[model samples]
Target: MINSSPGTSQTRSITQTSISQTRSFTTVSLIEMWERFGYYGMAALLVLFMIDKIGFADDHANLTWGAFTALVFSAPSIGGWIGDKVLGARRTMIAGAIVLACGYLMLALPVDTLGFMYASLGVIVVGNGLFKSNAANLVRRIFEGDDARIDSAFTIYYMAVNIGSTFSMLATPWIKDHWGWHAAFAVCCGGMLLGLLNFALLRRSLAHVGSAPDDEPLRGSRVFAVIAGSLALAASTVFILQHKQVAVACVYAAGVAILAIFGFMLKTCDRSERAGLIAALILTLQVILFFVFYQQMSTSLTLFALRNVDPAFSIGGIALFTWSAAQFQALNPIWIMVLSPLLAFVYARQARRGRDMPVAAKYALGFVVVAIGFFVFGLSGRYAVEGRVSSWFMVAGYGLYSFGELLVSGLGLAMIARYVPARMGGFMMGAFFVATGVSQYLGSVVANFARMPAGNLDAAQSLPLYTHLFFGLGWLAAGGAVVAIALLPLLGKLSRAHQQATQAASRRESLAPAPISLNAKNV
Candidate 1:
């Protein structure tokens, strides 16, 4: 056999590495897709389910969802740390998936009691806390050191979320209509099971990647401890969800705690790390604002669809198809899927040319479009027929909102990857989710501004309440855009400092002498 030249061998090696990377990323994406399928499937119907079945009033339902979601998002902070320190990211993710599947199965049980529902939600909260950040950290690890690839990869990864959500959001509502609520929840359980199976089949694709713990054999004692702690946490979550006052207190406390964590990190980190942490903190605040807008899709917007927006897709006088109100939530993910590739292409191209827009600037631009989207929602009222706006308006508004999301929330994780150090990646990712969780609770509070008054209000009576809220949200987004723009110069300075410090550190590493080997062969 003829020996290959170095050049040919190098090229072949690179090709194989690329293929492995692709396979690993694809496995993670598909798993995340299915997780989203189950989560969004349940989310699409949860508020409505509470209102109709549990007899929760409008405000109560909105706040309860908000509180539950806040806890759901916040749980990731501890989970991410666990992934980094206690369990391997890969193992933690697998465990979380299993827990989530069990949670959905609980919802599938034929119980409509308040206690049962709250317990089911608590289980989901625990699972999400464990699953969300570790899964994201895995993707970050897969493309470590390549900032350009990180952004593009996360954007595509985000598209996976929408892909799962779009199908579930549409299907679950239809399933609820055709079969019943519990049957629909069972479908969500089935999706998670499918995800777990898919992950198992391709698990070896990730064999070469994970946290420090992955290299160590798992201890039975550690596993037992984690399980016991998780059960306690799950029970606490049930109590938290049941008590709105406690949730409010927890949200505020968490908000303050995150700020303190950032301040402490900034104070303690090396010069090389300080600027990056500052940049991340600023960007994290922007993400919080963006998610507030996001929260409306499930709370205020879905309720608006239920009351004021016509649910039929039509052209002239021809009706195409009619969707239930909850199904309209699918529009956000649908538009996300449509926009993700286009944005990813643009990001990759810009990165190649070294002309990519700064993340802060993107946030400003995101808020501008988010404002426009809300304005579209507000304006839809102008042409309403007997207080019912055409479904096309929702489509148009969601498209714009989704575009803004691409700019802001879609890049949020990429921002963490770009700025935060690899060692801090898992925990900071959790912190970012904590910020989003706080905003989710705040968003629900915001949704209450248009909470329907008790009694059966006609569509005409309800129309103005939503329109007024939409217009106010538009202005809030506009203000956010202004603030983001105002911070760009500061962000630019910080970004430069971070880059320079990073390069200087890299030079130190490269120029340093190699360690002397003490082995017998070397001696």
Candidate 2:
């Protein structure tokens, strides 16, 4: 046995080694940061640009935005396929970054037509699909077989997302205020280009990470075929983006198909692994619901910030300065930057003390926290003097939403690694996004219900709609959290089943595996 007191130098070295993660982790995180910077910046401005600048009907814009974001999440499944089976992760990612840059450039061109906007969105969607999942997949690969470290690493990687989002959400709106919409889109274009350049610079650090697949090398004629096929697929996405009905159908179909596949895979796993998969699926459903609420930060909530929120100051007498509805979106990412590391420490401390929050409880807590945010948000509308409420209401809601985000989406990555089979890593990561994809659609559905008359936020009829719709959603989400918490025992049992199955397999291997090693050469 080896034992050392905390004061000893040996203890200090062990601590250093524990704290230091892979070099690839940081580089990939930087890639993610810049990618999110463009994505969220565009996202924060998209709806407002449609309604305010392009004159799209509110209903039309919301549906379009929802469908576009849904595809953004869903497209990753195919992207993961290309990464895992066609081009290597790194190459696919680089190609995607280029596409992303092109997409943003399209947006920056100042074509005020709906068709052009949809085309730009489709290009970004396909680009995001290719880039997003492959990057996360690389992170997962780096920490393979080490469950203990995977959670913290994924948490850190998820942090990169908010860090970038915070800056973009804050900066893009300000850019739009000063330089106009085209300039804002140009900023998004510049962000993606920065990401691509960073990835190239840091390519050497990631060589051992997302390398080309051994069996699926890009060579000669095959490369041409892949390129042509990708182009065709990209064209199809543009067509779908222009057609709302078709895009909605595809999103629903993808969601159902993914669920069916995950269910079949779960049935095939051994008893131990089966439990974790089942728990993961259940938790994923809850996560979908959480995103249904989260997605509103850009849509309905943005509307609220514009019409109902007082941008001059908060309820607590703190000064508030939001020049545009889009600028308000920055608050969520800012809160996330503050909250993620703190929550990670709480979870790490819990684990160190031989106690960990059960998967279901964590899910429950996330839902509850978000529910409370919505609850407060809903109340803000009621307490408003005349038509305006304190900006503090939205800020506080964002703070809570940020905490829940870390608990659910941040920890959800770790949950996937813990619960699912290694062979299914790429598929499962894609499947996780499928859940998010569906949530985007669902969020749109909910936001659509709160839609006021087009360009009529100041209308008397619009005020009640925002207040009551949010209040209803808050209660509904809180109730859902309560139901989830009650089912904690079941989720915990499934988690234990995974452990038991692994133990049973180990016992069988230990007892019967010795004889299997007595091959002719050994004998």
Candidate 3:
């Protein structure tokens, strides 16, 4: 009674394949959501906690945060190698979740000493290094060879980040107000634990995927080695965070090292891989510029909200509930959650129509919007009443900023997945993150340009400082846009070469003769 036609069988196979991929993607996305929840919950309060409780001056706080985050981002380079070669991506990711939970728990303790804080941050940097790149690599693996779906999938995956961050960014600040900061940090720890549990329950979905090591039995010696190495990295992180000059030197060194690494890869890789790497490098530089603007959400923008922006939403003489200054950080994720789906839809549609835009072109448009968003922020000063802009202005500016983020930062990982060969995917992904980390530190340094003079400065005195910085940033972004546009012709040519090489390689593989069995000859 069952039909056995090739068409019917092929349709069923496709359906099953789709279901399996969806389940795997969902499992990874959910864990990522929880991880981000823990991370953002802590992030929303970190700088303010340093300033208000630790008594750091604005410059010291900004630079310190920059250094800490730089280390956090840079650690992934080593982690990606570990995931690809030593332990399986799945196992490494789980270990990272455990380490991150412990780090958050440390912060929840009542110890407010600088040493304790630095140690806590060090642990987090190690854990993030292990977790971030591997999680992204898994997503890339799940959709390998499917270029169109990769873009849409990553955009939705990005939504997972916003979903987690939005809740924690809003909730952590409120918890700090009521239960105290330690309690808020405890909630972050709880979020990580929850993510680990969620992953445990659904991990079978990824049983067939991951690096070569995933297929092998567990090795205790490997686990021990990884743990020992992680400890050393964590200690070094503590030292780095404590020394501003050392951190700066390390960041610059990393920047140079990444460029050299790219050059080496281009020189050594086959002709097929060269074009893609070149495209990746050019796009990566654009990402560095974008993150400088992105870092404002946590640093200067948060400080702006604290000093120069009205906290309450209002309309036509009607009053709404007010938010804590820290909670304004939630706006970026809120807009991201709203916009990710729309952008993903457009990408999917364009891909299906065979009219997909180049990622390079997307980067150009992203900077255009980013420039506009900063301009909005800069111009908001013109409308300030008593040196405070309406909350609506923040909403509008964040909307435009978040859109640019989708086009550039959201697609950053996808760029790696598309261009890098599968053999080097993990390491290259790590390198991309390293680039972003370097930029994160740079962004913090840029934030210092708006650093206020000591003393109780009111909103009126601080407003101009932030607006001037915003104007300068807007102009910088406009320049970035112009440069991106100028490079489009080159990027387009490289993209075509990469695509032709890929197709040629695929054809060669498909046309190769099947191996002859010795048994057939014996018969």
Number of the top-ranking candidate, with lDDT as the measure: 1
What C-alpha lDDT does candidate 1 achieve relative to the native structure? Answer: 0.94
In model 2, the runs with Cα more than 4 Å from the true position are 1-20, 211-217, 220-222, 267-272, 314-320, 454-460, 503-523
Candidate 3 lDDT by residue in tens digits, 1-523: 9769999999999899889999999999999999999999999999999998888988888888888888888888889989999998888888888999999999999999999999999999989999999999999999999998999999999999899999999999999999999999999999999999999899999998799998889899998999899999999988988888889999999999789879988998998999999999999999999999998888999999999999999999697878888899899999999999999999999999999999999999999999999999999999999999988889999999999999999999999999999988888889999999999999999999999997878898999999999999999999999999999999999999999999999999999999877796667
Q: List the residue pairs that clash in candidate 3.
A: none
Which residue pairs clash within candidate 1? none
What C-alpha lDDT do the candidate models reach, one value each? 0.94, 0.80, 0.93
TM-score of model 3 vs. true structure: 0.98
TM-score of each: 0.98, 0.90, 0.98
Model 3 misplacement above 4 A:
1-3, 517-523
Worst 10 residues of 2 by lDDT: 453-462
Model 1 agreement with the true structure over 43-95: per-residue lDDT tens digits: 99999999999999999999999998998999999899889999889999999
Q: Compose the digit string of candidate 2's lDDT tens values, residues 268-331.
A: 8766677778878888888788888877887889988878877775436666444577888888
Candidate 1: worst-modelled 10 consecutive residues by lDDT: 143-152
Tell me how far the alpha carbon of residue 254 in candidate 1 is from the true structure, in angstroms, after superposition: 0.6
